[model samples]
Target: MSSVCVNQALTDDELRWVLTRLDSDKDKEVFGLVCKRWLHLQSTDRKKLAARAGPHMLRRLASRFTQIVELDLSQSISRSFYPGVTDSDLVVIAEGFKCLRVLNLHNCKGITDTGLASIGRCLSLLQFLDVSYCRKLSDKGLSAVAEGCHDLRTLHLAGCRFITDETLKSLAERCRTLEALGLQGCTNITDSGLAELVKGCRKIKTLDINKCSNVGDAGVSVVAEACASSLKTLKLLDCYKVGNESISSLAQFCKNLETLIIGGCRDISDESIILLADSCKDSLKNLRMDWCLNISDSSLSCILNQCKNLEALDVGCCEEVTDIAFQDLGSDNVLGLKVLKVSNCPKITVTGIGKLLEKCISLEYLDVRSLPHVTQVRCSEAGLEFPKSCKVNFSGSLTEPDVLL
Candidate 1:
């Protein structure tokens, strides 16, 4: 047979099979450059897209990527030159993409309740949505989503200050399948709201209420009790109202808790930490207690001794934690500690950090910044002793300091 006839015999499905086997997006792009038919097939096969979103851009995207399931219109930093996605763009998205499952509108400041209402009415299959930092969103918008998107499993409304108890009530009533929720910086959500939410959403696994000042022990304790078996990751960073009471409740109920972040919770004392370490010894893998003023060597020692599977620990700014805490790292079970951050700890000296470097063979990241006794010269001299794969941060720099001649 002739070469032209053999090439013409290849069907669309065969071309698509070849496209799927391409190693990278670059290779696929090169394949698409062959002809207009290949380009159209690549566009139709695309399932995920991340690009700058505006009314015209979204229109173009909806026409090109007909089967897009995940659309990311998130902007890390908003620019004045590029207009943010607004309600009209969302209307276009809802009308065009009927099967959209994951929609990320992070930092889309122009979005409002009207835009979300459109999404709720159209995108019933939406399972994941992130509206973090969308200051204009309120309960009215999220309530619409809850009423429509019943299958929602993940929702992040971090920095949406207008969200209140009404939104949680709506979610509890409809979105009972919610597994992960991030309400960080939602200042208006108080204990009553959290209590209402956890009463129904008992299957929640990951919850982040970081900087929710109105949330205290009452709210967190309710979550710990209600979602005891399911809750795994909990972040209470900067929740000054939280104290040992919440920690005690978590220790008693949430045995599966894996990651706990209580940074800036000054009220957490050694007693509760020790109890928590003992109770969650087998499950706890990551613990961040930075700026917890009451944590001392006693609790630090208890954590190192108990949490055999601990992979990451951050006790930065715990003034009372001294070099004695690092002594426990020598244990065989504790050698698996991978990431340790003791930055700004005045009592931790070169001796303590050196001990950690020598003991933690699998350590990948070590942050010793702002330690008074860990000077650049000392770090330079001891740099060779650190794990070959580990990255050390000293005085805000990760590079190894040059030793003086």
Candidate 2:
């Protein structure tokens, strides 16, 4: 008198077909525990696996799925029970998966140079590796990666403070095909490393050097000179020492530049904006200059007039930007503008914003937070109607800034 006999009597072929129809790994895993017949089918077909388990569990998973190609041991809020996997564990895991191409070890605190070295030696075909927030990894571990994984195209080493010029120099020489590199919070990086990177990694397109305080005009100039033709996106958030020289260099040389962020670079003035508006007008799509206190209405006007293709613009905390800037910003030439953030700019009012919204037919998001006069009630009082395509964000509303520094 056993209950739930829906699948107990089915033939092996019928059971395998039902297991194959399951789209999620979790469901298939639960079914695998139903019986030995289901376990064999589920394990053999699995090619991707995401686990919060320690090395022992990872080894068990590898043994079950012989064809596994992608593995993620990154931290997750939902799976807090998994202990941080260690170096010896990585050595074991690396040997288990010969076809592993992508491995994400974000915030795996126990992993160090030794663990990464093991991965590099075993997984030569690894193309994407993210070790962001792994505090224990240093140059020694990265050097091992550079020596072995020549096919790596995207690498994220954000928050790894011990990485220096030597690590970058080594990567530039070995990972020549690398297109994206994230070094956010690697404050020790300076001109020497960037110079070496520009010389060797000419094909690099996206680079994030946010919070690398030591990177100044000297390093940025080299990037602009060497990778200008290929570099499409550049992030220099919190690089306080960067000034007009680096801005000018980018404007003059970076012909294909699309997204540019210099948030927290207080040294940037109206001149840099005008230069950028003039040089990268045709190519520039997104521009961010948060905390650029020196820029005023003139700079905004210059950008609006020239960068007609801009889809996203952020000038938050630019206190000098007044209502006058919005007059030209609403013109038909900037029809492509979809997202605009003017938060913390004390000078903008209901009149200015209403006018801008009326003309920006394609605008979908508007952030006017912290401006006193541009509230929802005030816009209604002014008899202004926003386009159906646009979502107006007023003071104290739910809107978030398009870019955060």
On TM-score, the leading prediction is 1
lDDT of each: 0.89, 0.85
Off by over 4 Å in 1: 78-83, 328-334, 379-384, 399-405
Q: Which window of ten consecutive residues has the lowest lDDT sum in model 1?
A: 396-405
User: Considering every candidate listed, which one attains the maximal lDDT?
Assistant: 1
Colliding pairs, model 1: none
- Residue by residue across 21-94, what tens digits does model 2's lDDT show? 88876798898897776788778767788876666777888888888778887886454444377898799878
TM-score of each: 0.93, 0.88
Q: Tell me the lDDT of candidate 2.
A: 0.85
> What TM-score should be assigned to candidate 1?
0.93
Per-residue lDDT of model 1, residues 345-367, tens digit only: 89988788777767688988888
